[model samples]
Target: MFISETQIEVRYAETDAMQVVYHGQYVVWFEIGRTRLIKDLGFHYADMEKAGFVSPVTDIQLSYKRPFRYGEMATIRTWIQSHSGIRTTYAYEIVNETGDVCVIGSSVHTVVNKETFRPVKFKKEFPEWHAVYEKEKQGQ
Candidate 1:
């Protein structure tokens, strides 16, 4: 699998009263990782939006294994878990500087017309993007 890794410095704003990174922050990190993966694959999400299509999250799952503190460095690893004509699933793994896995997750998304909000087949609307996703998907 072609996994893209993005490093993030835990900020105080991302922490909670418990002094650990806020759980909700991981969701933002997931978006960062996914965006990096798409850039690494030579695609710009803005281009997709400019083309009048938007990929919206349809499902999401996350498992938190450990807590990280502010000022710590974390790496978010992301890859295409699966892809179909209509939907794509992206998997993620987050680890601390010491290389301990802190979180694992997946997000599913489907392309839709920006104005109509109607579902669109990725293979038909963005064949090049769909082809790269199919080629890099982790499993059948």
Candidate 2:
């Protein structure tokens, strides 16, 4: 359906002693992908926060296939896997320059009231964003 593509250049610091990307770095890359995808859909995380809510990662799963070396370019593909009133799930793929899939993952998030830290229905808080997510999620 609707997919967002973002490019990232691996940095030396992101690698380990073997010059391969450390296992933890993939999580950061996933965030980058999520941020781009939301922006591409015409919404801003900061604005969401300013509106008195925050979307926190409630769950995350990552799987590594091949190794990604430092200094290599990567294409991160991200999409909304599912979106409901209470939660949104996003899927991700990180591929190296050679078109090899380096990792696949997904993250689950839910919006919470900023001050109370209580879960809230996204559809009720942001109808426009919910509409966009509903349309894009249909493609998945």
Candidate 3:
């Protein structure tokens, strides 16, 4: 699969009063990872938005395995787990410098017309992008 890795330094502002990363920050990191993954695969989310489509996460599942402190660097590995005519699911892993997984999660999203909010079949709207995704998902 087309996996992309992104590194982020834990900023002080992203931490809680306890100095550990705030739980909500992980979701932001998830977005960073997903964006990077798509870009690395030669597609831009902005381009899709410009074409009158918006992809919104319909579901998310996160599992926290360890804590991350401010000033540390975390690596987020992301990949497209699955893709269909309407929805795409992405998998993610946030790992510490030592390569230990600190968080594991996945997000499911569906493309919709920006104005109408009706679901869009990606394959019909962007056949080339869809073909790339299908090839990537097969690890070709």
Candidate 4:
């Protein structure tokens, strides 16, 4: 399986009055991690759009463990967990620099025609990209 890791520093503004990072911020972090994962796989969102496709999250689930405070560093670990038809599921783990998992989550997305908003089968629209992800699934 292919995995991507990205580190981000928590800004003071991300924290609430109690100083713990706001719960909503983790969702944004998941997006950042997902984007990095796609880029690491040699695909860019802009290029995908230019090719007439856009992937949008269809579902999301998150579990928060330890809370992160401002000035801490977070490492987001992301991986493709599954794919079926036109949809793919990506999983993530956000850990503090101290090595504790602060949050675990997953997001499901489907590639669609940017203009029509109709789903596009991966093999039909991007065979090469589909092959890459298939190879990844085969323990590459």
Candidate 5:
């Protein structure tokens, strides 16, 4: 399994009135982690878009273990949990500087034709990309 790590600094705007990071910000962080993971695997999501395909999240699960405060640096760790022919599941872990896991989540996504919005099998549409995912996926 290949895990990608991205460091994000909690900003004041991302915090709630209590000065703790807002819950919704973690969803955005998941995207950041996912994008970084793809790039680290030598793939560009832009290329997928240019190919007239888009991967959209169909399911998402998140669990919050701790709260992050503004000015703290958090690490977002991402990896491919599993990948079917048409759907891919990505796992994420957000941790504080001390290595305490603050959040854990996963998102399921499927590729769809941009124009028709019909689901497409990743193996058929992007064989190379699919192959890499298959090889790198965790918990086989």
Candidate 6:
């Protein structure tokens, strides 16, 4: 599988009263990782939207392993877990500078038509993008 890694520095404002990263901040980190992954694969989420398709998360689950303090560096590892005709699942792992996993999670999203709200099959609309995903997964 092709995994994309993105690094982020924990900001003080993102922390809780205890000085640890707030739980909700991880969800935003997941998006950063996912967006970077898509862009690294030569596809832009904005382009997809411009094509009249919008991908919205249908489900999300996150597990917090350790607390991250402000000013610490964290890395998000993201990969395509699976992709079907209408939905795609991305898995993620957030690790500290020492490579300790701080969080593990996933998000399930479906592509829908912007106007009609109907599901879209990526293969039909973006064949090359789908093919790249398939090839990378098979190579793994």
Candidate number with greatest lDDT: 5
TM-score of each: 0.97, 0.97, 0.97, 0.95, 0.97, 0.95
Residue pairs clashing in model 5 are none
Score candidate 2 by lDDT. Answer: 0.94
Q: Per-residue lDDT tens digits of candidate 2, residues 18-87?
A: 9999999999999999999999999999999999999999999999999988789999999999988799
Residue pairs of candidate 4 with colliding backbone atoms: none
Pick the winner on TM-score between candidates 5 and 6.
Answer: 5
- Model 5 scores what on Cα lDDT? 0.95
Full-model lDDT for every candidate? 0.94, 0.94, 0.93, 0.91, 0.95, 0.91
Model 6's C-alpha root-mean-square deviation from the true structure amounts to 1.0
Cα lDDT tens digits, model 1, 39-65, are: 999999999999999999999999999
What TM-score should be assigned to candidate 4?
0.95
- Residue pairs that clash (backbone atoms under 3 angstroms), model 1: none
Model 6 ranges off by over 4 Å: none
Candidate 3 CA-lDDT value: 0.93
How much is the lDDT of residue 123 in candidate 6? 86
Looking at model 5, report the run of 10 residues with the lowest lDDT sum.
Answer: 131-140
Write down the lDDT that model 1 would get: 0.94
Q: How do the residues 1-140 of candidate 4 rate in per-residue lDDT, one tens digit apiece?
A: 98899999999999999999999999999999999998999988888899988999999999999999989999999998887758888899999998999999999999999999999898888888788777876667
Prediction-by-prediction clash tally: 0, 0, 0, 0, 0, 0
lDDT of 3 by residue, 1-140 (tens): 76799999999999999999999999999999999998898889999999999999999999999999989999999998888868888999999999999999999999999999999899999898899888877788
The residue-level lDDT of candidate 2 at 45 comes to: 94
Task: For model 3, give the 10-residue run with minimal summed lDDT.
Answer: 131-140
